[model samples]
Target: MERVPLSEVVSDCVRRWFQDSLKEAKAGDVAMQVLVGQMYHSGYGVARSEQKGRAWFEKASRYRSSVWKVSNKRPGLNASDSDSDEVKENIK
Candidate 1:
């Protein structure tokens, strides 16, 4: 899939989405953390900071790990798992 350019992202909406998803009642969703990481990484809907990006990416990894440990779980339908090392090397 083609990625949406960082410059065009709606920062406010992304912020709102992340905040709302963090609420206790809405905490069931796991993708929010990943989206937050992506926003930080690309500065699409947030300020650009590699430290922040890494932090969020770590959070995403943790979320994925948790799911994997539960009920034989894996990435969900909308989850954006990273490509394999082989695929990444090929693209370089």
Candidate 2:
């Protein structure tokens, strides 16, 4: 039986991390998008790809919301931004 090289194993793990993060980023996960961008920029989990990094950073920037708008536009953990009953009935 032959053993896999340590470098090969480590590279595989990093590549998997990149792939999983890419999936989340594609699904509108803003944090994951930024992470993917940073990973690309620093060659952390994948090869250094500055072009892809910039593109992902641009995407994350687009998703950023202003502080005032967060109350109205931010999605909850389940990815739903539905207004609460109190918010719906306001002026209380």
Q: Estimate each model's TM-score.
A: 0.45, 0.61
Our model 2 lands, by Cα RMSD against the true structure, at: 9.0
Query: Candidate 2's error at 43, in angstroms?
Result: 2.4
Q: Which ten contiguous residues of candidate 2 have the minimum total lDDT?
A: 72-81
Q: Model 2 TM-score?
A: 0.61
Model 1: per-residue Cα lDDT over 1-92, one tens digit each: 98877755665666665456445213644576555555555565456666765565466566575322222122122233433433677889
Q: lDDT tens digits, residues 1-92, model 2?
A: 99999999998988888889899999998877776776777687788887887787677767653211222221221112223443666957
The collision pairs in model 2 are: none
RMSD of each: 9.8, 9.0
Q: Which residue window of length 10 is worst by lDDT in model 1? A: 68-77
Model 1 — TM-score against the truth?
0.45
Question: How many clashing pairs in candidate 1?
Answer: 0
Error at 25, model 1, angstroms? 12
lDDT comparing candidate 2 with the true structure: 0.65
* Number of the top TM-score candidate: 2
